[model samples]
Target: MQSISSQTSKPEWLSSNLLLQPFLWAMSWLDYILAPLQNLIGYKRMAYFFVLPNLLIFGIFILIPMLLNFYYGFTGGDSILLENRPVVGAANFEKIFSCQDFFKPNTCAEDLFWRGAWNTLTFVVFQVAFIILMSLITALALNRDVRGRGFFRAIFFYPVLLSPVVVALIWKWILQYQNGLLNAFLVSLGLTKVPWLLDANWAQFWVIAVSVWAQMGFFTLILLAGLQGIPKEMYEAASMDGANKWRSFWNVTLPLLMPTMTVVLVLALIRAVQVFDQVFVLTNGGPGTATLYIVQYIYRTAFEFRNYGMAAAASLVLAVVLLILTIGQLLFQRRQEAA
Candidate 1:
């Protein structure tokens, strides 16, 4: 009996020892290197030493690229190499803005850019509004004491884990005009087949809807956390005052959830502005540039058109817009906190 028990335990002990040995050996080397550094820097400043690697990485990958992009925007040439390009001042921006009228895209020198800008604006407005509403509704429903709540939450969140390409491909398959699932279902119900992606109006609508559906889960989770953080006693007090569910939600929940909502709003806006991958895969900015957002415009200009300077200019404009949005969010949050 003792020999049998020893045999069974041997594998488990050996497996743990194998894992532990490598990890312990690595940690000992880390300690040995860090000890000298720690002594040289002092404990209080050791934090900065540890952070130096991340700062270096950020400078190399992010900061340098951003500066180069800014410089590229001022240049004009066929070549992407900065040194080969000639300085063109604000010619690209002037071209983009050169129009008989601001509202008339056809009048502009860079009419495609204007078209993309308008489409992006429309998409952002509708998409952001729908995302906020749907996520809030879903979060509220999931927050309730319902059976299979955890299962349902996971189901809703599953799409967020999917790659943008995968999401587009799945929907593209489902919405195919010939022999698609949705069209087949409609035909079965004795309804006429709709050209979901072929028509400009339908294509634009579905793009926004698909974008909202894909992103709603992440925002829902954020709002759910905010909802969970609210003190239960507030709701109890509201009930004691004879407030109904609607009244309680309006007075208590909305106020407390504003911060989270602001976060979701700004994040959704930024993502919506940068929307390209899924829409590109799904629509390819087709049906007459109806779904051509700014990012896609920049992409086509750079790679397809081989106009690197124009693409860089457009990207700089986009970056400025994003920076403004970020700063606005920070200011809003500061004011909210102060209040």
Candidate 2:
């Protein structure tokens, strides 16, 4: 009876404790300040109040810059100040879009821009496909019951926590043409040193390979989570229907995993499109611009060449592409939900 009485009084004792008094006081003060506002807005409309701060931040940092970028894309000058810039409407777009043969980048007035566009397209195509395939495989392998699974999962995910520059630098050392780890291994095996970075083809290959190695872990984690969320009963049901393992995976797992796969695809595409840091640090758009992507082109134009207008124009193009992709993803998600 005494123990029961103590348990019942414990909550009251904790609430009246000196250590919690300051926090309670602070909360009371906050409530005092918000009381009038809450009364005016009502409980249902209070979500807007909570979101106001984040909305303001997004407007200032993202919305404002996007508007300014669009404005600057139409004007041309060496000056960074918008007031000092001359309105050369559509000229930047014309310069970028003009080409005798769209396939031949050198035919364009802004050949470097065209080159960067082609290179970015090529990179996105290869990188997104490879990353998705590799990530799915890794997730599947790790999802199974295996020895040292936790350790292997950590090992795979450790690289995603690293800085992009660090990942690039690490791979740069490993793949360097001369006096690098891979070259040393080749030399030991009585093979001539292969110029991985010096040759344009090999440079692009290494850049893509390194990028996949660095980022695949993140996607793997996402897919693994999705895989684990599937009900064990679904597989049992498939087996009861006399479906083989492969057939069950195709009929049950693939359909169930489509939403997660779509998310991975869209995110991977966006990341591939915005790829800059890894390529910048790894190859620096090297071997005669073979690996130069659109973001690098914009950076070079804005900072190196002092062509802010052109850079802004290129950025707008990139923004449009990304917006379209995002919209498409949303539509796809909606359709998936409807179905």
Candidate 3:
């Protein structure tokens, strides 16, 4: 057994392996080409060579699309092709913002767009709040010296591994009005059946709840890492000064965890603003567009209505909002660090 293990571990065995030979050959060829270039540019500048491939990919996939989307926002027509479209200036923006009462979406010319914006804002505010609170609590609980800690952690994080659509489908099955698992259980217990999806308010509530459940694991993991990175000596010092657990947590833990908490908040806010898949699968922005969000609005405008220009305009507006939020978060982080 020892001899067999030794033979398998040898470089000669690796070289002879069919599966790895192509990759090995490619690497050897790449190294051969890079050797001369490395000498010309020096080792320090060779970092650019390693980064060039990724930069090119990013430019092609991300940067080009963004520029096209921005340019498309200024044009109007039913056509998907950019070259044939006529530039309509800010007509799309004017249509969107040409509202008598900004608070009342019905007053807007593009009422559904405004409705989606309102719903997205509402969702982001509540979702971010609940996600932050729940994640913090869960992280604190998991970080403690508890029994079956690994099992509990795995259970909490398991949902995060599932795709968004899968998560939505699972929840939909559990929350269905007539034949859902929850409704069945309620019937068995002689309780009233709750209209989870049919009603507007209830639909919004369930969407937010399921979203929080599906995503809490990731934020909790981030918070747990932040908690672990904190210095134990600070807690010890607080204890020596006659501080209780709550006091120590407030003073030491919260302050130290602020940076990680900010990251979680920003990411959660962005995701909430861009929410689509779960809402689409679970509710389809239904019950009179009550749960409709901005991304869904953009999608419908482009594909369903075939108003590509309007979709592009709405997308640019969404991008600007996100960019502003990101810039604000960065400025706040810098101020915190300076302090």
Best by TM-score: 1
Give stretches of model 3 more than 4 Å off.
Answer: 1-22, 32-52
Error in Å for residue 76 of model 3: 0.5
lDDT of 3 at 279: 90
Q: For model 2, how does the per-residue alpha-carbon lDDT over 64-130 read when each residue is reduced to its tens digit? A: 9989998889999999999999999999999999999988998999999989999989999999999
For model 2, what is the C-alpha lDDT against the true structure? 0.93
Instruction: Tell me each candidate's TM-score.
Output: 0.90, 0.87, 0.89
Candidate 3 achieves a global lDDT of 0.93
- Residue range with the least summed lDDT across 10 consecutive positions in model 3: 6-15
User: How far off is residue 96 in model 1, in Å?
Assistant: 1.4
Q: List model 3 lDDT by residue over 1-339, tens digit each.
A: 988886776676565769688988899999999999999999999999899999999999999999999778889999888888999999998998999999999899999999999999999999999999999999999999999998998899899898889999999999988889999999999998998998999999988999999999999999999999999999999999999999999999999999999999999998899999989999999888999999999999999999988899999999999999899899989998999
Residue-pair clash count for candidate 1: 0
Q: Candidate 1: deviation at residue 323, Å?
A: 1.4
What's the CA RMSD for each of the models? 6.3, 5.4, 5.0
